[model samples]
Target: MVAPRKYPLELRERAVRMYRTSDPRPQIKRLAVDLGVHPEALRGWIRQAEADRGERDDRLATAEKEELAQLRREVKELRRANEILRTASAFFAGQLDPTRPR
Candidate 1:
């Protein structure tokens, strides 16, 4: 399960917007201190905003990343279920064999 974010969505958007609109982009650490957020977190938000705007292509867009995570979880669940079913099928087949004593 995803953990709740410490910073609200509005706050993140505002910070990213401010960073984008500033005449001279401020240093990430300084801006983070002013906003009471970690510098690395602030930098991530900026990178994500740029990716959303098509200005950067260094990483997957947010939606794509989320979808990928969801898909990976589904694949894992499927693999687990397949293993359980395979084990059950083998057990049932052995039970039905007349060659073995009950």
Candidate 2:
């Protein structure tokens, strides 16, 4: 039986990088075959990475706080924009009202 890898992260990443380059398919296939893992698993890893490309944090408890922090920053920016818009709207409304004396 093969020794289970507690940390395949680095090696798996290298293998994925090799696969993406102009490296031959046979070489990639042979690497996976020698690793005793299905080729599709490598593809799945790459796909998952691509899917999470833009997502800074994942759906984990620790990441949740990071996500919340990011969301709070975004909300603060939005609130500022809304306040600016409201100010502009009020100024325009006051200027446009015909019944109010200039």
Which one wins on TM-score? 1
> TM-scores for all candidates?
0.83, 0.39
Error of 2 at 60 (Å): 7.7
lDDT of 1: 0.93
Shift of residue 25 alpha carbon in model 1, Å: 2.2
Worst lDDT run of 10 residues, candidate 2, spans: 54-63
lDDT for each residue of candidate 1 in 55-78, tens digit (9 for 90 to 100):
898988888889999999999999
lDDT of each: 0.93, 0.68
Q: How many clashes (backbone atoms < 3 Å, residues ≥3 apart in a chain or on different chains) does model 1 have?
A: 0
RMSD of 1: 2.0
